[model samples]
Target: MKKRFCIASLLLLCLTSPWIAVAQTVILESPVRVVTSSDRSIFPESWLSPDINAEAEVLQESQIEPSRRVLYKVMKKYPGHILARNLETIYVLHRLKYKGISASGTNSRRNVYVVNRGSRERYTDAWIERTFHAEFSSKLLRNFPQYLDNDVWKKANVESFKYGVSGVKSVKQKKALKMFDPSLHAEGFLYAYAKSTLENDFNSIAEQLFLGDSRFWSVVNKHQRIKEKTDLVIAFYHKIDPKFSRSFFVSLAEVESAEIG
Candidate 1:
């Protein structure tokens, strides 16, 4: 009985040793929450370091902008944090928006339709290959943020603009048509509209653009049968250049032909 009790105690100590080690390591990463004298919670405990808690408290007591500054400062302290990873994603998307027309159809208006498809395999792989960083743990952080960034997610778009006139030939246009979804054609048009009229460039006003009785389905439906349709409302100013107008119909026709074949 004495021998058995000694062995049992030894086993418990062995099992707990690793846990205690892990706990000690975790304390190095754990942050403390600071409550300001003014009754404000300066920063959540989960996001800050024990050393920074006092700084957060001081910032809060001084009535400074706590949330934004905390995020910025915390990133400075623990640049490898998951929050820093997400912030990098945000920064990348913002950079890509000005690059124009994502291959993933980000700002191109096909976003709503693309969501219906079960697989985002192509887009996911593209992001993982191009934008994957060591810090992001959640798949949601990588994928959905592409949609939110407008059209900065597309590779073909970058290629098209780089090649310019050389890339606008028939063969290239046909390939471009394939990347586009039939349902999102109107959103593309609306995007162009928003660009030409409001800001002389594309910007998302998703709320106003998507309003209507059919919930913006009418806008999408209008482009369903271009041959039967007499007039098109392209761009924001409705400036219908007959030449540019033909490009829209021709592109859709190529898509239909490709689908049939």
Candidate 2:
């Protein structure tokens, strides 16, 4: 009986040791991650319509107004790009693109644009821009599924000199490069929208946009600077549509860095 008791005590000590170590483990997670999946949002339908009167009528008639409206907007800070009178319309246009037609440019480079003639509001241009971004994101996911896998980011280096090795006209042939570099362009936008410093909690926005999770909106709501976070994320995403209307990047670092508190 004495030997059996001693063995049982030893086994208890071994189990408790692991628990003690686990209790001491440092859990480095942001407060932003606490957002529940129920917090995710699909932009409201009224946001897409250019006619405010029509939208209001529809809302009153149907008794439909979402509790939240994705809480993000993408538009041109400058004059040349598109503009939306109501921010919600931007997302509406995006949702519309999944069903609308996509037209690529005549050049070898694939520059896609959505055709939405039914839209009458001045903000129509901005909505179209939003659609362009949605289309580009869709294509990238289809063409480069590899980017979504394995966090190990692999970069390639290729140099082409105009001059030949033997001083011969290096211009053996100017291999006509494709219209654009989708990945590089996508990275540029991603970097631009990324919070200026690691301290900023913009990664929460990145996760929803790139990680295929809509719940990030709840995280945005928790932040004291909700508008700032929402504006930054949307502006940055929209900026890239015209230049890289075919694709964008969602880095592994971005996946790991989003704050949930």
Candidate 3:
């Protein structure tokens, strides 16, 4: 009986040891709920440290706005505990920091879409990514390596000015487009729109499907047959949203198309 009791006690201690070690190592100042959000697979295999520590490290090192740091800190401490949901946000911020985008005062002012929210409130990754995705897509659109032949960026600029987007491409057009301010547009399916507008007859209706509207589809159904534009929309949305399917935008567009049909 004595031997059996000792064996049982040893087994219990061994079982609990892992938890004990985790607890000791995870012992954080301020009882950080946000810092405690470690053990997630969302972080890249390379970050090496625990999540919350990385969060703190990122906040300390990254050039993300002062307002953002304050907001994240409040979120870490507050009742909303929104940091738990912001794993992708953190990752993007880290990547942005890596790219030195945060440090660019001119770049920061020109492009980002900042929305105000309460510390205790939560936001979705999609919401955050949609905003940040612009940075990526804009960069993708603007900087085409060896883009002199059929340059999409230049072509789009010329078309927008031709279409009377802010009244004619002027001498300052190149300077204006170079600035970060042109990226603030909430336009739908940007890549598709750029490509589609370049089509001789497709015109605005091809781009309009991205606006999440029906009337454009009606016009499309009645007047046109450019199937590639739809294909482009599907492809571009999947770029912005990895999980998006043809049926997803199709359904949204169908609603608008049906209404106007």
Candidate 4:
């Protein structure tokens, strides 16, 4: 009875108050949440620059393979030289002699990387040091099986596969076929030179220089073979760039050994 009387009194008060006739109102609002690292962004947004956007548009229109796009970008960075340009021109003229593409001016040198699947490249710098190795060397090694047994990495790789640690399932199929000869040669160089490096996490200068030679297949797992290839590469570098001495690589290895010790 008392509760009903209180409610009645409140209603009566409201009805009697002149301020109530002014139209009472109530408003509700949600509180904003504070975001931190725990709050993830919906999208990764990059700064929109006009030049970058234009290049991206061109690449999108070309519809080339990832390898071709990478090759084109690499070729574009190669410094223009009279020898490289002239040699490329002469080669192109001879190749297209039947088609009358003259040997004058800038021939297909600049556009060599732009060839279709038929005019595939015989060599690329990526065979040495690329952004993605597993994709660059080892992937090609798979398609080219003949080189698989020749690398210093061969024994370890086979052991890994046998133990099921390499994560490669097609060991049997890979052993059965040969790949392009150049791939075999390059892969052989990598695995051989890979053994001769500064005892650090990074690749040594010697390893990088060794890759310049294509006939690194002469290198076997034997200690003397690795030294022979190593010496030849160092000599070539000496002829081209006088600053690079054998001691340069030796000192780097010594420094790495001391640091680790």
Candidate 5:
């Protein structure tokens, strides 16, 4: 009887081992990695150009975990394969600058950089998350411009309206990048900085879409121009991946609001 019981116990363990291993693997896996400036490989080769003058500070030890949590929350919304193929690393720093100008965040080939909240800075987790989405969307836009119909995007804007030369110039001028202005909604723009360029406009919409900002949906529902542009943005994303459907974003917003509530 004792020998028979021991054999049964060993068989049970063998039968469940693979299931336990899968559970452990699922718990350990993360879509992307959050790194600091200490990892020299995070810097892009373009920064080496004399004209770039890019500078960054290493993140404080206390800031690392919070930054990771925020990034993980944002990245987990996408499919793992999408993340692996596009973004792999997030570099969190105390500060970032280029050409001697301060920047809240920026992206290189496959890595994105964001500034940690400082004593004097107004940076918040929401802001950081939005920056991550905005910068990453820029990379996606560049990688797959064919899906972004410039003619369709331009038509959605006000007739005969012209965009500013560059978003960089708008940032350099100290414009409020994220402020929501009702006055701009009729023009199919969500914020002042979006009017700076087509890419910035797309980035603004992309950030709001991915962040699942309720206010953005409110505006989209009330204004025809904003709704039109929003549809274009949704179509652009859906074209890139079928997973980015309207229902997915609607559900994402509900989930975000529930977490906040």
Candidate 6:
């Protein structure tokens, strides 16, 4: 009968809709979901608007599990309330380029784009985890600039130091952006990349903070400038959430080192 056919059609539409499929794939444990699809519709309009020229490839199915594991671990470091209020999704890709330059990761206010390690890629698990923390911290800084006082951060640096115009410009000019350099720690910088911009400086510290490794602490303990910068970073996160204290970070570092051992 025509009534029976109409009912069947409605049921089929609901079952096969893309929205339904996407909803089912959502991660329930956290507010943020790991998105692997390259489909534009899968991303929110606001996320796409800012980076219209960004290009990405779908993440390989085999890489999804490992990528998700790393992402979830990084997300777990943040307070639940902070994650719920600030982050919505993380889009994993085999490759991601913005404005024709290859980038390890980038972010908008609510979403992050990260290139996952491919079979042929040389990226390590540590690099991927650092990328997530770095990019996510950039998003958080943008969302809550008041927590980080630029003058205070600058005061931690050498008197004559000045950051480059932008991270993109630094990349375009082929400036060194290495992740760490003990020499730079004496100057209140983690590496050459930290000089690219204030945001980059913040990101460098944030990645190491979230990483909570012994190497980072060793430098912070030995270098007064690095210690000053680290203190500011700790204060910034603490302002965002009181639970993110100096002791909390020290304990986090201890736990991470124990696991590595």
Candidate that would win on TM-score? 5
How far off is residue 2 in model 4, in Å? 64
- Predicted structure 6, TM vs. truth: 0.83
Tell me the spans in candidate 2 whose CA falls farther than 4 Å from its real position.
Answer: 1-111, 118-123, 149-261
Cα lDDT of model 1 by residue, 186-216, tens digit? 3343332221221111222222221111223
Q: If scored against the real structure, what TM-score would every candidate get?
A: 0.18, 0.21, 0.27, 0.23, 0.84, 0.83
In Å, residue 146's CA in model 2 sits off its true spot by 1.5
The 10-residue segment of model 4 with minimum total lDDT is: 34-43
RMSD of 1: 21.5
TM-score of 4: 0.23
Per-residue lDDT for 204-261 in model 6, tens only? Answer: 8888888888889999889988888889888999999998899988887899889988
In what order do the candidates fall by TM-score, top score first?
A: 5, 6, 3, 4, 2, 1
lDDT of each: 0.26, 0.28, 0.32, 0.28, 0.79, 0.79
Q: What does candidate 5 score in Cα RMSD to the true structure?
A: 13.5
Off by over 4 Å in 4: 1-222
Candidate 5: segments with Cα more than 4 A from true spot: 1-29, 38-41, 118-120
How well does candidate 2 score on lDDT at residue 248? 33
